[model samples]
Target: MSTLNLLRCAPHALKKQPVWVAPSRNIALSSFLRDAPAATASTKVLPGHEYYPGKEEYGTVIGNREIVGHGEIPYYSDSFMVPCPAIRFKEVDEELGKLREKEKGDWKLLTLEEKKTLYRASFNSTLEEVRAPSGDWKRCLGDNAILIGIMFFGLSVIGLSDPEFEPITVTNEWVDAQTEYLIKRRVQPVDGISSWYDYENNKFKPTWSIFTTKETSQSVKTLSERGV
Candidate 1:
């Protein structure tokens, strides 16, 4: 199934697992954590004011923009320019240092199941459109909001204080690492869930890394190859 559906269903399947709320082992972050925004068919990106008129015929920026025409939508360019790696690395390093300090003493307090449930529920509620009413366990969580909330919760339980947006840097990297690690470790595991290690003060913090079953991964691969 799709990543969003898995997250929506996870809480019910794994109730009160401490790992869901607060994981104790290092896990990898999966695409499910990042797919919400992209998965919503209702979502759309309006063209930015910085349109490239010169490259209109180049099939680059054109794919990037979405224009409505003749009762249809057209995609322009796909190439998105990010900052230079050197600058990115420096910024990431600075952020990581602060996160290390902010997350100090936070480690493996909650079980992996609890962390997962909380993470999944919070993520759905915060990020995606909430199908269930407020206070429902199955609402979607926002990527940045939920990450910060969970990170803050984890850190606060251990007597640490977060400033703001600190978790994004840490969570994004952790998620990427987790996804890569899982894809490497398991041959086509499930698609939506993710795993990762929580760290603080240069030490690997105890946290549960969520993972998809190998069987599910194989099924996903089979379906994907068949374009199902």
Candidate 2:
């Protein structure tokens, strides 16, 4: 393969960019991949899209059947819009535990920096609590053993999802740039025209230049050139 093609085929092998964009929001691969097979047709992972029943449906089924219309309701239709896979929480947790144990030994060997860049857990913890404490578990280093262990657990699950992509080393510059981009708001107009002006007539027309400052111009140029 050509160099470009080879790189495209193995993008994760490239040198780290200055930012990381998580592929999915909140959904961990382990929650799906580690799950046990469905016990019934309702629970199966269907090929097309799926729907989750809203509170009203769930409440009607579990709370008051009388509130719903009088009829023999179908099992799947009554409780949820999607297939109600017959998996129990206990079974799912047990399966996840087994999967975690299978990978924990090796995941523990990865460096702290690698864990953060690779999207692995920074320590060990339940997935629900993985994002607690302001999602700043990395800051707990040397102080919070519980959070660190949870981060460790997250790493193993992420590692199991992709075998080839090792986490890249993160830099402070990368983190700063990513944060700035993440928090940037849509553009807005400045309220006033405050500029040093040269007099043409009695009128103080502004300078022809659009750039307000050297720093601002330089930053714009850097971002445009790098596509970061």
Alpha-carbon lDDT, every model = 0.35, 0.36
> Can you give the TM-score per candidate against the true fold?
0.14, 0.14
Steric clash count of candidate 2: 17
Q: Residue-wise lDDT of candidate 1 within 94-176, one digit each (tens)?
A: 53444434333353554566454444322323223343345644344456678889998887766645345355534544554
Q: RMSDs, each prediction?
A: 35.1, 27.8
Clash counts per candidate, in order, are 62, 17
**Residue 218 lDDT in model 2?**
45
Q: Report the alpha-carbon TM-score of model 1 versus the true structure.
A: 0.14
Query: Candidate 2's residue-wise lDDT over 1-228, tens digit each?
Result: 655334322233232222222223454767444432322223432211112233344544433211111122312221212212111112224534454344345766756654443322211222334335554556666468877788999999889888787434344345436423532431332432223222233222345237445544444344434543
